[model samples]
Target chain A: MGSNDAVRKVHRHPERQRVDRDALYRLLDEELVGHLAMVVGGEPLIVPMAYARVADALLLHGSTGGGFALRAATEGHTVAFSVTALDGIVVARSLFDHSMNYRSAVVYGELETLGPAEEDAALIALSERLLPGRPSEVRANTRKELAATRVVRLPLADAVFKVRDAGPGEAEDDGEDHHVWAGVVPARRGWGAPVVSALTEPDAPLPPSVRRLIEVPG
Target chain B: MGSNDAVRKVHRHPERQRVDRDALYRLLDEELVGHLAMVVGGEPLIVPMAYARVADALLLHGSTGGGFALRAATEGHTVAFSVTALDGIVVARSLFDHSMNYRSAVVYGELETLGPAEEDAALIALSERLLPGRPSEVRANTRKELAATRVVRLPLADAVFKVRDAGPGEAEDDGEDHHVWAGVVPARRGWGAPVVSALTEPDAPLPPSVRRLIEVPG
Candidate 1:
């Protein structure tokens, strides 16, 4: 085992602050999906979902027929939500001390069902959040489509934000002479080459949302 | 919400299947690092850890002095174990319907205390698993380091495997005509450029085990 495998409070770096409320919201808004875990019938169920931000709440949408979705809506059980992005691997002199630099958010809250108008707005917000201005470019949801969907909004108050950034901790014996290449190998995420749909008409121009996002910096 | 957002039983493709128990063991073995969650003092505690496999069981090592670790060892609480690899971003046509392609295992089992010899074997197995062949190259653990570590093993029978593979699913009517770019964005995991430890002598070569896995074939 690596020497630093301990999960004690001391190992939990305090310097990795939880920024603030707005920063937290920004992080949530920027991400397209999250993992939702809840205790249902005394057993834990974890499911992946795409989510949107509604004021100080997170909005999760699913089919009206999904077992978890129906149960969560009808019973109003509290749920745990988590979003994680692995940024880099931290290799230390001792194998046991190796670590991962990551950003994660964990939240617990009861979900509130949204009415028709609220649901539509939440869906649009989610689309826009995921692809910046993409919602305006794509065809809007039809009334029939809206009738078959379900949306749940959960307040963000009961969440815990945990993050680890910066380089790996330096060992007490770390020095110039130690000769350990002690520095971060940065990881970056961005779009790769886009593939046009096979059936897309030759006349249909590339959507502005995709073009704009590609131009913007992450 | 996109039309494919309804209840669907995701299929497991052949290439994604584990052909042998050895493959499952390798998956468990390769990911020596994990996050273990269980109830401690009536509240949930998530502990990051290094684990080893012995026969059909998984051994988790912790500091004998740690709170949750000690409490868990003495109380023998039931714990949930999960190991996940985020393989790719699966972009389906629908915003609410999009999903991630991932591999994850969830296990629920009671923890057990490991005997001295079992503990030693577990550590060696874990080290060799993390960096295959490292156990032979590096010096064996000292008696002091062994005495300071606490190892607990959790068995396999009570586990369920869930996975999502293949490309994203589209709604019945949201056919190939939608013109949206839809497919998976692949993610790769392997050793990055190795950083030689500053403490190592100038001409020291990377051990064979480390070199072997540096660029593992897909």
Candidate 2:
């Protein structure tokens, strides 16, 4: 992937770290959630949350009444957010060589509140990201509902993206002699049979976005 | 799935949350990796890393060279660690009721370094926790390796164990028509085929512990 963005770096094994704009965009678009990490009193805390993408910024929405979210908004602190999917485990002969093959992104930035118009757009982006076509199916957010929720963006800057995909390497000692079972347990994602809400008609078809989900080896 | 030991009221669904001592111990044992959340400098951060459990305490293995581990060793600092598994998504009718069915333990306390004997015990326990019987197959840790790796343990106290599970609650307007998909995607765990070092014999049978893995539906 080409590194067209300022926040991304090739890092060591530039091949392993994708810095291209398209790759980064796809990574963000495919994942539905991220773990947001920040330093509180110098200790590390992580929160798993959902998110949406809009151009160069990623939108996060939460209740203004939430303790963590409120503290994050009021303090305006810099935070690190990561989205990772472990595809498989790479087990080698030596313990130290045992590692996981995964796609991960670490983004560092300060939270910025969305402006009046941007907030609405961000929510739409988030709704579409999570439910896809359902954003149009559900009733639009009322003025009161919008006022109660908080939306903010964390720009794509100071980020590191790393990935490793391949089978395990041969042991250093007698290469062919080490006979151990070796293969990958592929991770996958897919929607289960949809359940019609108790209030819905018995045979309402699944929405396009939910139905159109593509399975990727996790 | 009893409320006998649950820490959070909302997370104490009997059918969804589990409290078997053996099960909890096994959950912590079979898993070699987890997310560590800490409060440093009044901010929260989550670090995803490998971990090992030893007896009644959880040992966080790290290097003196790493910044986070290094700062943790300094006196007069407190750290809280949590391990969470998202078992399934509970898609309720109302947005306010939407939640995840998960198993998590939040540990609060100051971390302390293990003594020489405790370090040895910790490493063995960690090995067993990660690979079960493999501690016997692999060579024991050398004094140098033990000395090189730093092991810090947080006592089991000050921990809040929580979980949630069950189907969505019926909407108050149940007779009214609606169109929403709701169901569950059960999560399962077991040992994948183990990778033998390229140098191992091609037909070595896996140790009993690894081969006799317990598959649990979370």
Candidate 3:
């Protein structure tokens, strides 16, 4: 969480930089999908994967991440994971100053693959993050299934959290006409009605977790 | 758009791989921010950048992406960019089959700094993509501002696209309780009303582009 290093520098918009652990945790908790970035074959590669923030570490589903993230972990290479929530759009007086309202977090660390016990817990944690309060409603993972799933852990020690949530910052002395309106167009995300698939029983009741999911917005 | 390259493989979910140009084009055109991944100081780094698809190339705003992207362009290093639209979450009968419905794209290529004319056009294209018709509403960037902006271009080649759009795909004979209701929870993103800043004139009218953005959902 120190700021003296080159990796943590927010050079362009230093004012937007945040070093608190809460910022990073909130960002990871809010987004279920993160772009897991790694060096593959001497070139950069990225795969969008389902992830979870368990306490202070990140658990990545290697199968969903294309299995290369697991390989990177075994190879002892440092990987970077990034998540973002585009809050809104800032319409400025000029195109140069036009920007986006967003909260972005990038975590960099060497990954460690979890063993059987931790893997089961990590996969359940990932599922809970993706669909909260749903683990108790379904069956547990079989032994083969647990072995098939690859979960890697990355400590939350190194990360950068940046947020921009404000109105336009147009200079007062700028020569643009104030009559040209400028402000923000906020973004909102919500969950729609639960769609029952054909395989489900016609009279089967929806789980309590799903009812909560429909009622809440995340 | 060929799929014979190493970077274009979608191993785990081979059935979800898409080779059509429409799929790739639509994914790029829809999202404004992408995770730009590159190797910095022997470690993986990912930055969420505002990007636009112009013709057959991706134009990244270097200033918004941070100065390192421009430096990476000049250094002749390759980078990867990824974008995702989480359409919904599939609540399957079991935890193993539970997954997210998403459209993800990853583009791998080296970057090139744009010339003056191309930079101006690319900048306009970036803004136009982010806020559809708003480019025409705002004033042009000043000469000094143009000089300060670093716009890099990457051809839309050697990319991979994967999509999962169907409902829960639980097998008929998988031997789970039929009474466990399962389905999909759709995700929706919409723009709220614009908040006029204090600096704007009281009677200033909202631009048509802003109105169009609110009326149409992307």
Candidate 4:
């Protein structure tokens, strides 16, 4: 999938572009914040981070501070990460086709910097792709906290994804007024009850990796 | 709050940066999706948009198709626009302190482009900030759908606003194992159950602006 000239199709919905590499690893394994962009000083920054997807790359950790993912892994430059997710809102009865049922992706390369034994297996594959059965329930990284953390991998071979998840295209001689309540409102993203930390142990029990992330589901 | 040299403080927690103006209008009125970025040909593209926040600016609309927000509103360049939200995931106990309780902002300037009489009041303040009371319950834009849409805007004076809503910053002889389950997993973002439109009228009802967005409160 990394080949129709690898990424760059979808000049604004080129049929919701998706050169499927399993829909770019299912929108980089169901998004958890991404945005990274680059070119600092000559402006364009972006930021947001927190990423994961460890196998074909895309790791990104920080705190060796002076960050922009540690200066795009010490100036190898050329960045651009993205991710997105927002899957559902598209109410369309026209506010110029009110849309938003996203999935996004983006990628673009150059970021490597891992070493120190591949940043402790890219921080335990970014804590098992952000806490899925919690990297064997915590407690491991210590070489002085993996030499004060920095990670940075980025390589889903120049990605692109774009989905939209249907519903609301409205156009049967589209003259508006179909009694409007037009479909889709979805936009979910759950996991609420788990505020614990007063420094834990006030009956220390909710940890089957945080009760399987609030019984998973959203 | 556009001056401590206005917007360039958080280089990675320069103390959760935020130069206030009502915390950049409550993270651009509780975000809906932003990203945007620029520099097209020499790389860095980004995209995702769907923005809103009317008054001090930040609007963005598209469809005149040669995309990247109509080429960053026709090459008046300097783009950026971010917006994040994420609000919770912090499951720390170290995976190098697993973070993410975001609120982001970003903004860096130059987008203007709005005239079709201020693109119909920035598309009714982006359809009343994305369907909140569904732009007085639908049906309005028609001057050939406001001459095929494009909008733009951007200003909130070079914004910044980086928040990280606490819970999980542990340190007390920091050696791990204080009985696991470290806090925060919140990440809410609601609004589901609305499906309605197959062309509406299957006994058409659910409206009070989609029943006040499923009783709001996320």
Ten-residue stretch with the least lDDT total in model 2 chain B? B1-10
Question: Taking the tens digit of each residue's C-alpha lDDT, what string does model 1 give over B25-82?
Answer: 6667656445565543333344445566767888776411233544553465556666
> How displaced is residue B202 in candidate 4, in Å?
5.2
Regions of model 1 farther than 4 Å from truth = A1-33, A52-55, A61-78, A128-134, A166-218, B1-35, B40-76, B124-139, B174-178, B189-218
lDDT (tens digit, per residue) of candidate 2 on B1-218: 22212222222233443455565666566554555545444444444455676666788763111235434333545555656565554443334333444565555566787789887777666556544565565455667657755567777655555555555565543332355554443344433445454444667765554454423211
Choose the strongest candidate by TM-score: 3
Per-residue alpha-carbon lDDT of candidate 4 for residues B26-75, written as tens digits (9 for 90 to 100): 77787788887666554566767787887788888752122544554456
| Better candidate number, 3 or 4, judged by TM-score | 3
Worst window of 10 by summed lDDT in candidate 1 chain A? A1-10
* lDDT digits (tens) for residues B108-190 of candidate 3: 87788788988788888988988888889988877888998888888877677888987777764278887899999998888
* Deviation from native of the Cα of residue A187 in model 4, angstroms: 2.3
Instruction: Report model 3's TM-score to 2 decimal places.
Output: 0.94
Q: Tens digits of per-residue lDDT for model 1 on A1-218?
A: 21212332333354554747776786787666566655433433444566777788888854211335445434555565666565555544443444455666666656777789877788788667666666665567778767767778878876556566554455543242234333333334455434443444566565666667556533
Full-model lDDT, candidate 3: 0.81
Query: What is the fnat of candidate 2?
Result: 0.24
> iRMSD per model?
7.1, 6.9, 2.7, 12.2
Which of the two candidates, 2 or 4, achieves a greater DockQ against the reference? 4
Q: Which stretches of candidate 2 lie over 4 Å from their true place?
A: A1-33, A39-45, A63-67, A94-97, A163-177, A180-218, B1-32, B38-45, B54-56, B62-75, B90-99, B161-176, B187-218
For model 4, residues A1-218, the per-residue Cα lDDT tens digits are: 22223225665668877788877787788777788776655556676777688668788775212364466435766777888887778787767777778878888787878778888988887777777777777777889878767777888887777778877888632667677668888877777888887777777677787787778766
Tens-place lDDT per residue, model 3, A1-218, is: 22224754777788787887887788788887888887776677788988899988898885344675567555777788888989889988888778899999888887887878788888789889989988889999888778667888888888778888887887642788899989999987878889998888999998998899878754
Q: Assess each model's interface with DockQ, reporting 2 decimals per model.
A: 0.16, 0.24, 0.63, 0.26
